[model samples]
Target chain A: MSVTAAKGFTAAGVAAGIKESGGEDLALVVNNGPRRAAAGVFTANRVKAAPVLWSQQVLKGGAVSAVVLNSGGANACTGPLGFQDTHATAEQAASVLGLGAGEIAVCSTGLIGTRLPMDRLLPGVEEAAGRLSEYGGEKAALAIKTTDTVHKTAVVRGSGGWTVGGMAKGAGMLAPSLATMLVVLTTDADLDSAALDGALRDASRTTFERIDSDGCLSTNDTVLLLASGAAEVVPDGTEFTEAVRTVCDDLAQQLIRDAEGASKDIRIEVRNAASEDDAVEVGRSVARSNLLKCAVHGEDPNWGRVLSAIGTTGAVFEPDRLGVAVNGVWVCRNGSVGEDRDKVDMRYREVGITVDLAAGPESAVIWTNDLTADYVHENSAYSS
Target chain B: MSVTAAKGFTAAGVAAGIKESGGEDLALVVNNGPRRAAAGVFTANRVKAAPVLWSQQVLKGGAVSAVVLNSGGANACTGPLGFQDTHATAEQAASVLGLGAGEIAVCSTGLIGTRLPMDRLLPGVEEAAGRLSEYGGEKAALAIKTTDTVHKTAVVRGSGGWTVGGMAKGAGMLAPSLATMLVVLTTDADLDSAALDGALRDASRTTFERIDSDGCLSTNDTVLLLASGAAEVVPDGTEFTEAVRTVCDDLAQQLIRDAEGASKDIRIEVRNAASEDDAVEVGRSVARSNLLKCAVHGEDPNWGRVLSAIGTTGAVFEPDRLGVAVNGVWVCRNGSVGEDRDKVDMRYREVGITVDLAAGPESAVIWTNDLTADYVHENSAYSS
Candidate 1:
């Protein structure tokens, strides 16, 4: 059974008047498994949300029974008053669930620098705590969404019995170099916080951090992993690690797929760099490229933009050592345009380009969405 | 007497096979006067083009009697052979015009890494020489077009009866720090190359470098300025320099106005920054922001994108000391969302945002285009 499919986990979503449209604004989830072990990953953005700070420190103690999340008002840069509001919301949830305030985690999304509507939020959290159930994953996922088009959830079952479930929410303000890794992971296997942190960091590098669409990291990013140890035995070694990665990857892809007004997802891979660090820098250079992203949106395989991007990195390399391929065709070789580039088909819903530095074998890949008009339309309508 | 209305300058345009549509593909300009003094600025992109390398060395002599330019091919990253082709193109232009090869300069625009169609180009250069005219400033501008929807040209009169007329072409490959700065400055003023270079660098810093919209520097970038000394009077002080900057600023603004699919022109001014460098960095940081650009496109007034972008810079400042305003309205003060944010309006076609670091009097201003779908459609179509 999936971790979310385990016993006594309930969720509820309701409009708490944070967003102007008054859409789904808050979510609540409680773990009543008879065993509680929780861990989390927060945003690397130095300017973090009050909720992120609250959740991160709470997860340090290793036991969490509930998570209260809200979309539409990211309680960030709201100073001391914001933190006090977060504390009040968590306390209200604790009072309703017959648990201490320290046993809860809080997550907030939406416009930054805004304080929470404490009166509405407190009641919302209390209602969420009262509605906890075994099949509330869907509601919780829906409630945590901001500009995301759809709810993001992933469930995987391990051999011998343990299952891991996770939910994520983010659309824009994502460059997550661990953008908003805001995640709630549930599992029936018991892993200590140290083990969870190790797994989380590894899983995130290849997944969340790969969504480099806009290069803007969010203020509220939290990823929490809770284990009940209800399973007899968890899967072994790379097998278990692979499962965790799979869950993380799925959630990450959804984040990109649902990126604000995104028309296409472009994956850029740089191979043969001098080192992995150089490779990551090269990949990131291209990923953060507005020109490259715009070209991808227009279906133009402008390899020149690709080469220009790589040239900006401080990494050392000969210009001639660079080679570029678009959608599997060698578009450039030895730093010059390759032969028969006209025959290459760059039109695709999903485009992949590879830059071969020819400096070494170390490589990395980054995932991002094309910059489009809709991206602007989706973002400019109001001050969120 | 504007530079375009100046004497001793003749221009011509022709449809070489460079552009697929067979529009005006080649442009030529000549100084009838006996003396020719010129200076140039090439792309700082590490992957320099063959023409850039050729021109940088040629400028040591500080003179160019004529220039040959083509649209549709940047001729960048073409390696050793590309350099040979550039020299050949120059020799051909010289041969056709009965002049020395060293007297002519070459500029290319279009896709990078592709070789020029020398067979068609050689004959086209000869054909263009036969078509030169004093009214050729317009023709020269058109001959240098690329993905840009319009041609960019500017002319200004310097002191002492000297005229400084210039033409520039660039759009898609613009960003801060620099982009395609292909310019031809013609004047009767007699100035040394050293003086010209110093003035050009200063003008560029305040203008071209401030218009970084896409954040990607191009390989084909070249700003070629020539002074014929036909009027034979060099203005003392910064008069000539100011004229150059005025033209550069006008052209730079035009490029931003025509940035691909751009729906709005945004001016981000950073005031009260700790230092000029810090102010410029902060301005550039805000200008390079995709989420913020998108928000500006949507007219969303999402100040969170603003504060988040500021936090990414190395510029030291307390978050609480930051103040952000939209269209003169302080939406955020002391790091928190201000009460008057809801009263602000973002519906106008032109938008201005101000960020005060509350540190010092130093300030900087950056001009950028909003991220739009047309930008996507234009870049994605096929320059691969």
Candidate 2:
């Protein structure tokens, strides 16, 4: 419950009235002090949301003191008017917090195309700003969700006061390489923008981009990291970077856990790939496979679907080099159908399938949800 | 119904006793010579079935006269033993017809792992050979089905006496660049093996390769085109190829119409790409999107899903260069949300979406089925 437990940040969440449900949908967080160095990551999708556009430009200055976020509308594909709204929102937060407009980042997520309801949103920003406290991290996590049923937050403590705390939200429209999930991380540890930016990218490679159940990347995907220099010590190289990465990985798993209509959270691990990309490609191919998802949903260990999904990856490998295991049981080996397929079970809410290429030693893992009747029912009627 | 109507072949379909139902599960087709030319197309999946392995070798020789197919057990992943089964099947057919084993080919599709029930199959094969007729095309087509609910056949008559007639069966395990589909074509045209090969490749490029729904390429996919030379006339180059391609397109549509558990057949066309590959990459990207498929199933004109799928194609493009039309109604333009989103309806079984890249004049089309709850049920309990 304490943001300061991991060092340098205070956060707060407030009911913004921006959401129809009147649930908490706005948050503000601050990084007090000496080294306000920060780095930000934005969705690679070309159809950037208005907030992503504004924040990308703001982060170019290499530091940020506070962030303001609103949930309920993506403020994307709304033309030039959306850009204006995004800027005004950031400016209002900057002025109220007695900071430069260019020093405060912004993000928004929810339904796409609708303009921000500034009448209700502007006042909510003031409430969030007033509630900012060192113990407000949990509330901040609750304010960034759309279809998520639970809040997601993670904290990693390192040597000294160096710490990494992060939170994210997304369920549907999720694919890695920037899932619709939005994330914000703050640390008291001092680090250069280049170092933080590099670390964020490296962390995202396996964390955010590896969950491709629905294969849809959101326009508003963003993750920002702020280093407040509040921590007296900054661990070097792998030590601090790994700590930051652990937080991202933990939060990513939480998002997968909340995937829409998901009855099972499946961890698809691909081992012995010729390369990490190959391993990831193979894993993503299976993760995004609707047929394979159905197999998992039925508690049917249908590995043929698994092999079929792997065959789609353009990676070079003889079929005989493949091996697959489900729930710690080998179902295929030496490049042929394994005899123990019937022995595998998947009656639980969590399933794991380990695919071994047996061609190389590298490995990768992707998180996904099963394709269930409810997933079909929910998405089919979503827009209606 | 006459395979000889295309001029060069005879066909027969009989109960192979391979299927427990005792239905017709074996088919035999022979090229009546003169045009003993064969051109073959197989699945692109690296993990090919035993028949795929045999056919790949057969095509290398360029001279094939007959094909024997069964539909009770897919000779795949049975390992080296699987290859032996295919060889034995082909040799038996060759011996019964007084031909060399090299002149015969084999294809099978059904439950994986379970070996073919040959006690009943050997006699079924001889019975099928004895029943061979110049007019058994329909039966041959029907015998190769696994889960397909209907028979698909097409005939195209060109200038002079040349004609192309064929059959195909594919319902599930579908993705393109070969899904789990089988196609056999017989023609009386006097084209050489090279020309026949060229036409089949061109036809497959725009036909079988375009049906990428589940993104699960099957191991047993095969397409064989045989010229029997019964027709004295022979067409060459683009014109002949175009005729061959049209028949393929027609049968491909049939496959889509009968895709497993599909209620809607969706065509995603991408235009004005930087290159044809780029366009195809984008189109295929949309076809494989489970979210889009679910939306189509629900009759939801969710253009956001369309944009998100295209964004992941890795094809470089300006956001504003993109436009989307669902059922001929523009739902998005200039990368901004379109006003007609509420107007595009996908209630019908045939739904079309045109995605304009505006990058260049290259274009590609992908045919796919909308994902539904029934699809999940069908595949999940396939083993049951």
Candidate 3:
């Protein structure tokens, strides 16, 4: 059960003929709750899609009764008509669910600069409203996929009998500030909008904002968390925030695992930084180094590229005091050759790179994928 | 004629057995100058190669009498031993040429974190010194090839019988601050060290500092300008600066054309920005976008990706007022659909992407290459 794993939430997926292959292309989730509290995070990209713009406005009220997401058309760069299309989508969903249009949020993904098939999409929304069920979370997850190989879902149980669960779909254009993905989360905790918003922003900062697959930010990234008071348990604030963070971290890992054309999932952990910001800055610089990614793909344990990447950042570290390890082998120590590189085995799908700044106690982790020929082929052939 | 195209310069290249393939890997350029005046630029990367460290110190005196460059071993991240190796190489060159070791500069490019084969390299320096000739500039250029397919050289002649000539070698790890390459420029203009320094910095700012091939900076980039007053022509400062800029620009273009595994040379021009820094920031962001580069490789005028790249930068521009064009076709105008993408033809080896921020009148250009499977293959297979 992903979003529907929590009480007072119903979801459905339907084929709207938006995708040429006639696959499920539309998903709907409704919060039938005594309390309609929600929070959201959007793409930092200024060139947002129409749906993103509409949802940002709708979310300002801190209340959302329903969400309508679709695949096969991003509805971006389509001029003012695109905004009208998103508004119409929300209106249709609101009418079918007997809610105000201001209480609905809409999201779209796929090829950008295209208009949605409004004729097919409007009818599909009504059909999806009729078929909404508590067990339809998996179907909703499947419908939101563009290039994802599989649906991703996660759930966490709070000690006070509250539940937090979510689903995510992303395969490319994945980078930080936010990955190019759509996520809908549902919780049965008795909380106010202020609490939900605080928890969500905190959780997203440490989890979703740390995974960078290709370093390409998109115009359509959206994440929403909706709370319903069906479970009368008022969870402790710390417990509720931890649950949200756990679920988000799980889904973020799933996104990285399913990143397009990836051969290996690399974990870059920077330690002994002067500050958390410095640690994150160093991690991001290493994460975005295409040369280092390619070296990981080749399993060469080329630590010099790692140093070259770290050198580009303004992080506090002495060049001669730096240390690097690949697969638990200290291949470079004090910024020089240390152990035998042949000792590091990189035959597995997961690789670990550790960088020691030898400056302080702070640390940070950034997840990324190895660059492969298949990545180039997939991206070059598929126009976004 | 490259470095030796100008008067008062002699150069030679010889096989040092440092390269496993046994190609010419050692080069020497000597200034037979009535006045020894020079200026140099090295990589901004903090984890610099040993030779870069040595050369930076030599250039501080502004009187480099000779330069020794080698391929097949970068001698970087090799700790104190690497520094000693560079010192030994310079000492050998100085001893052979009957000059102080402080007057000699050194440069190396190849695999990082490896020690040079000093036994063969020291002997090769002696042989190169014995064979130094005014016509050996071409041979010197040929010696510095790591992955470059050809030697790059350019010359600009002044009206007053003075000339500026240079040679450059780089094929990968090219990015701003400087490309990962070794360059030696010689001029016959009667100028002092301070004048040469000012001209070299001014020229490099707009030339080598603008091209970003793969967004990877190297630890061994070095560019040097040596002035010899043997021709006794005190040329106008403006003319001399222009000549130096012309030669640097030509060599920069050659570096882009020969970028490893590149199928297209892309010129990204950002116009109508609030300031020149904004223009450059916007252009560099677009140039480094893997998605945009892949789209260019597929010959798809995916202007949405271009807009997405621009959105990630802090450059001043309204989302709806931004514009993008590919090869003269305005695929996106006013941040929406403009001309038909099919009208744009990318069937040639050179492509131009223009971004209009509509913020101000400043502009900048950044050169880059498209991402391709061949690029991934070449990088993954190469250990460095």
Candidates arranged by lDDT, highest first = 3, 2, 1
Instruction: Give per-residue CA lDDT, model 1, range A178-241, as digits (tens).
Output: 2344677777765666666677777877777666867877778777777666664554756666
Q: State the lDDT of candidate 2 residue by residue for B134-248, as single tens digits.
A: 8888899889887788878898888876888888878632235223688888788888888898899888888888887577778888889998877787675677788888888
lDDT of 1 at A224: 78
| Residue B258 displacement in candidate 2 (angstroms) | 1.2
lDDT (CA) per prediction: 0.77, 0.80, 0.90
**Clash list (residue pairs), candidate 2:** A176-A209, A177-A209, B2-B135, B6-B188
On lDDT, the candidate that comes out on top is: 3
Query: What lDDT tens digits, residue by residue, belong to model 3 across residues B142-174?
Result: 999988899999999999799999999995323
Per-candidate DockQ versus the true complex? 0.55, 0.61, 0.72
**Where is model 3 more than 4 Å wrong at Cα?**
A172-179, B172-179
List runs of model 1 lying over 4 Å from the truth. Answer: A1-23, A31-38, A59-65, A172-174, A177-181, A229-241, A342-348, A382-384, B1-9, B31-35, B172-181, B342-348, B382-384
How far residue B367's Cα lies from its native spot in candidate 3, in Å, is 0.5
| Candidate with maximal TM-score | 3
Q: Is the docking of candidate 2 incorrect, acceptable, medium or high quality?
A: medium
Better candidate number, 1 or 3, judged by TM-score: 3
Model 1 whole-model lDDT (C-alpha atoms): 0.77
**Per-residue lDDT of model 3, residues A1-384, tens digit only:** 899999999999999999998999999999999899999999889899999999999999889999999998899888899899999999999998999999999989987777899999999999999999999999999999988889999999988689998999895323442236888999999988889999999998888888888888989999999999889989999989999999999999998899888989989999999999999899888888888888898888999889999999999999888999999999999889989999999999999999999999999998989888877777777763
